[model samples]
Target: MNAQIALMLGQDGVTSGAIYALLAISIILVFSVTRILLVPQGEFVTFSALTMAAMQGGRPVRLGVLVLGLALAALVMDVVADRQRYRAWIWPKTSLALVAVGLVVVGLGLSVPFDRLGMLAQIAFTLATVVPLGPLIYRVFFQPIAAAPSLVLLMVAIAVHVALIGGGLLIFGPEGARTEPFSDAVIELGPAMIASQTLWVIGVSALLTIALGLFFEVSLWGKALRAAAFNRLGAELVGISPEFAGRTSMTLAALIGAVSGIVVAPITTIYYDSGFLISLKGFVGAIIGAMSSFSVAALGALLVGQTESFSTFWASTYKEIIVFTLLLPVLLWRSLRQGSVEDDE
Candidate 1:
């Protein structure tokens, strides 16, 4: 590829990777805290994209308005679902949580047939159905096995994936829907051209990341959640409930998904199964971070994005191969180092 073309491609890859990194951090956060892989995390991205597309009607809405609506809808759904499925359960809290989760999956499954609704309405319904469903899953599957092997919780997440995929197929059919980005214009740089939409994606993602980081670092509730994640028993000893932490984390995850979807939706078509693709990519990014630090995950995303962009320009077919090749070496080095440290200890 020409130098100019290579530069442009690299920039594009970096942007894409950054978004994936955000997703990775969100997923890693939940996993590290609860030891439960959150399968529904990608759904949040899909839900946000669909909602933004639905609300804007193929046109770009103001970013502020778009963010506000998506955030509000996601937050509301999360809070309501928590109360209904988890709080209302009478049996062992874990069983109740699972039952609540089942209700959500069933609910989303049913809503797929209502394709006639405008984008806004569909977005609302989807968010409303899924946000609260997390706690229910906790109550049902995780609760019963709370004391069991962490692998069991991981298995529950896999089950969630299976159910969500099946439901998407049943409800939305196999087709995908595309939404136009807010802007179609591109700006020329010295050696690369930047799409306005791409800039928006990068900017919005950065802003949200910064905002969330600040919140977690500075806010009382944020600290509580962190404490809960780090040590549930310790947090509870200080009166911070693990349930509260879990709920908060889920809510944050939902909002992150919404923002990611909004930024990514315009560039690609969204379908019921879009979550699977996103989940895979996000998982890769999260793993690159060793599934711990959010900042590291974000940086990993940037690297991945840059690699993809550059690879697409020079070797489109081998873009993924190239990126993973780089990732493999780094991962191997880290693994060996960790092993050495363990041996020394």
Candidate 2:
């Protein structure tokens, strides 16, 4: 490789990794707080991107408007939905679980229209619809699962994933959809040239990550959320409602998903059924973070981005092959280390 090419690859790797890190962190947030491996996490990304693209006339828009709208909608909807759907079934365990799956299906169904709507309208509608799903899931499942095993929650998460995929296919058809990015600016800094769209992705991802980190680290509610994630009963002893933490975490995760969607839509076309791959890659990034550290997950995401970018440059046809080949070894090593740590504990 040429020296300049190598340098560019390195920079791109960091930027790509940062995006992945945001995704990974979102996954980790849900997993850590709810003790559930939320598979629908990836769909959130798709929903945000599709909605934003649709809202912006199939082009890019101001990051501030996109992020603010997504965050507000996600947070509000999460809170309301949880209280309405989940809080009502606080007694029946089996029924509550079913309700959670049903809601996932419903969310998936609602997200389908994004592919068809005008870009601006799509963003408005998606944000309006998805904001409340987080709260609904928390009220129905995570709250009741406060005393349940992680395995049970894991199964529920898987069910949600299946439901989302099935519903997406049924509603949106099998065709892939494409949307234009917001900008076409390219900047040259010495030997490296960065696409304006990619730069926007990087900048927006960085700002959101930092803001979220600060919110979780500094706010009183944020502290309670952390406590609940680590130990629900302990948080309860301190007069913090674990249910509140679960709801907040879900909303936050969804918000992150929406932001990810907005940032990513410019570069990649989205399809209704695309959630699986996106979620898988994001989950990989989260796993790389050991499912706890947000900062580390962010690092992993950038690495993934670099891997994808460079792999594409080398052999577009075999890009996936090259990426997976690299990912497998890393995953295996991480798994072994985790096993050893558990054994020691």
> What tens-digit string does per-residue lDDT give for candidate 2 at 131-169?
455665555545656567777878877786676567555
After the best TM-score superposition of candidate 1, give how far the Cα of residue 9 lies from its true spot, in angstroms. Answer: 0.8
Candidate 2 residue-wise lDDT at 299: 71
Q: Return the TM-score for each candidate structure.
A: 0.75, 0.74
Give the per-residue Cα lDDT of candidate 1 at 236: 88
